[model samples]
Target chain A: MSYFVSPIAYIVLLVFTVLSGVFFFIYLEGFAQVQFDTRAQLFQQSFSLTEFVLQPYFGTISVLLLLIIPMLTMRLLSEEKKQHTSELLFTSPITVINIVLGKYLAALALFILMLLFSSIFVIVLYLKGNPDPGVILSGFMGLFLIGASFLAVGLFASSLSQNQIVSAVISFGLLLLFWIIGASSDAETSVVGYLSIINHLDNFIKGVVEVKDLVYYISFIFIGLFLTHIVLDSQRWR
Target chain B: MIKVQNLTKKYGNIVAIDNISFQVNKGEILGFLGPNGAGKTTTMRMITGYMPASEGRVEVSGFDIADDPIAAKNEIGYLPENPPLYDDMKVTDFLDFVAGIKGVQEGRAAKIEDSMNKCGISDVKGRLIGNLSKGYRQRIGIAQAILNDPSVLVLDEPTIGLDPKQIIEIRELIKQLGSERTIILSTHILPEVMMTCSKVVIINKGRIVLETTLGELNEKLDGDNEIHLKLEKYSSDIKAKLSALQSVQNVNDLGSGEFIIKSRQRNNIGDEIARVVIDNNWGLKEIRPKLNTLEDVFLNVISSELKQ
Candidate 1:
């Protein structure tokens, strides 16, 4: 299908996959070289410094997902609406919900396929060195949640207008607000901190997939997609 | 069948279609005629649910445009003033996309073939829309609109910008399509309306100024025939002499030793005017009668209004 075969999707996938793989390798090398003194007897008798270095890896990947989701979703409805292909879509019996869902799924499917291809990094890590499989799976779970949440926000941005650039900018702006609020807040401002998508991924990076984090991601996706649906519906009125 | 009652469309304070009403029966071609800024396209857009009316309603095959837009849109096929086309898509792929969206539930390939064949763009189906000629592109546009085989077909300026031959071919195609389906076409080409539409509605300044059957519109302006006379001896007495004749309604000197005379009835004015010229010992260089035209009626109405 042209949807999967398009070079834009391939380029985004390659860039993100390589960058994350490089981060994973750097984290492993940093752990292997670091010399700890009394910290070795502080808590765990046998815990890999490699895993601790990779802790920030999942968080960094979450940030990468947020940064790149707009590239995948900016073209969904905006391109069709801009090119006037929307008339072909609108006059058909297909409802606005289906069009929105079809495009969203198409983008997500491409993203997931790319993620599958990058699982080679995980396999290589297991072959070359010993790492906890549970932590790896939990990191993947966090990646999926972060990707879906960002994609929903990007889709909502796409629904606002017929310009792909505008959609990408708005999606990035919205996600950056959430990421900054999640990182720089204390318990007193925990409300804003809890709203952070990266905050939800923090527990996952620590090999803990909390139900509350899952709910947060799902609710974020739901609200973003719900707003996209409303914006598309309002086009008929315009 | 379609009935638009008291249909008014306004963009804020500016009215686009003002209290317009018209009916299109089954299997008839209705021509919507108006000037550049007329409400013809606006009315069509409203009927197709591309836009909504500010007030009133349109019913297509008994389904209200606003109350039941999906059903009404399903029954009607619309080609807008500018064909909404995707340049990146191949002609066949574009038509397939249109068929998919138009909800052609069965025999989609066959229907697409039929539409392409009807529009005579089957040969260019493999080519991207941007690479096609203007005439072929227009055909693809029409092909997409008719892909679903809707009962009511609406076309706006379908033959616009086509060469003379292409225009005739498209006009003939529209006439053939009108035989089985109800058609509403808006065009500034008066002769195309005369040849294709069974009835016509003329609008001006966003208002329906006239609505009449084609035969009625033609007959209203029909004054039988006109005679052009060329005389070697030019004189003011010629007008008085032609006016006194039984069939002559009015005579105007063209200031070039020529005159145009309109007859009161649909009689052969060539022989009568020739006889009069010979009897008056006038050196008649030419005597020819012309039939009534839509242009004549249009100008007559506008000119009379200007005179008042």
Candidate 2:
């Protein structure tokens, strides 16, 4: 709640709303041009809006979320430390779990709210095009899972340093690494490919919901929060 | 009540505080007296459950801090050397947040109001904490500490970085609050302890040099004020002359016409030293009694502890 009152939250929200809106219109126009080009071809079969438009649209939104979630979470723990407010929190009757979970959930809540606003774009799609509700919903779920995992990582990174910028950089480095490292080859059974965060998302964007993907995200979130709890508790011991 | 026994803290090989023991009963304020870097803050941190001790234990209201930290911390309201404040937060909002975390449920609004009133920050309750003056910020820091009405209150240098009037006001506020709570206030300022505390614990270089009632500390401070004397000429014979005086207790030559004269507080030694200088044709260049430095007070406490 304190976070929502700050200007940074609104600023990040505005930037996200603008950037995702622009991405939606740009993708819609590109899909329309492709449809027109296909109309000139031999076959007059229509193109799937979910395939040519919202899929790519959600994909770009993921990238946009990746860039902005760090800003939302960089100060969660680092600002508490820098301002010495962690001392206040630690001395209170609160546990390390409470501290870690409270911050993660608050940032996650704001991210969810931000995701809700972009649903207007989905509403517009429903009005104009006959898109698959299941695919769009699956894509939204993937974004939610990815955002949750990213937020957890960002929260953990925030605990690693007292400087907000340093935490931001660390989370960015970690997230980008997770996104690009095991993406070298398309081998489906590669051990390293399983570690790639983006690999799980492809199945979700294609309207496939694998239980392994859900487990991966939930476990990722758990590990991130566990590491954060250890770091915060050890700060007291040190 | 707060009980800290054999409490020790170390950062790697550096012992921040040695094994220390002390307690503050209900309604008594314990002054943690020490110079800067003397581990006063470290001990207070341990007592408040902000930092875990490397060895030993702390118990508050029968809850061992090591065994049950949440209960122990629930009883303690700590104001660290730098007050933990959210600079961008409104004063009321910050206090509300603290009240929430401290779990003040019954009559929460009234309690917040009373704390703000006690700290005299009610006027600025709606203002941003970053915009307040140093005194107001300190007051707000103190307000948050007292908001929960915890059984134990730990304040470190509460009057530091304030003007003289603000210091006196804060001292009065502390005295008022000490009527019920067990308070441990750490500071390098000696007179602050004398003004607001019932007991004093003097620490020097991470070790407790002395622990006693403030009344006893007052006596030690009185008898240990040494008069520094500087004459215009060398003083081989002057040391004996000053030492032989009826009121003077001891004299030590500090080389090159300088001497330290000691005497009990009841004696009138200053005029006698001057009279002796005039009669013996010795020029009196400087004569000043040192009384206020924390080092001076610690020297007396350490001497008494050595005797013990």
Best by DockQ: 2
The alpha-carbon RMSD values of the candidates against the true structure, listed in the order shown, are: 3.7, 4.1
TM-score of 1: 0.87
For all the models shown, what interface RMSD does each have? 2.7, 1.0
lDDT of 1 by residue, B21-52 (tens): 99999989999988788788788888887777
Clashing pairs in 2: none
Specify the CAPRI tier of model 1.
acceptable
TM-score of chain A of each: 0.89, 0.96
lDDT of 2 by residue, A95-119 (tens): 8888888899889899998898887
Tens digits of lDDT, candidate 1, A67-147 = 788877887778877666676566555677778787778888887876676667776776776778888888788888888
Point out where model 1 deviates above 4 Å.
A1-7, A10-57, A127-129, A187-189, B223-225, B230-246, B264-266, B276-287, B296-308
Report, to 2 decimal places, the DockQ of model 2: 0.70
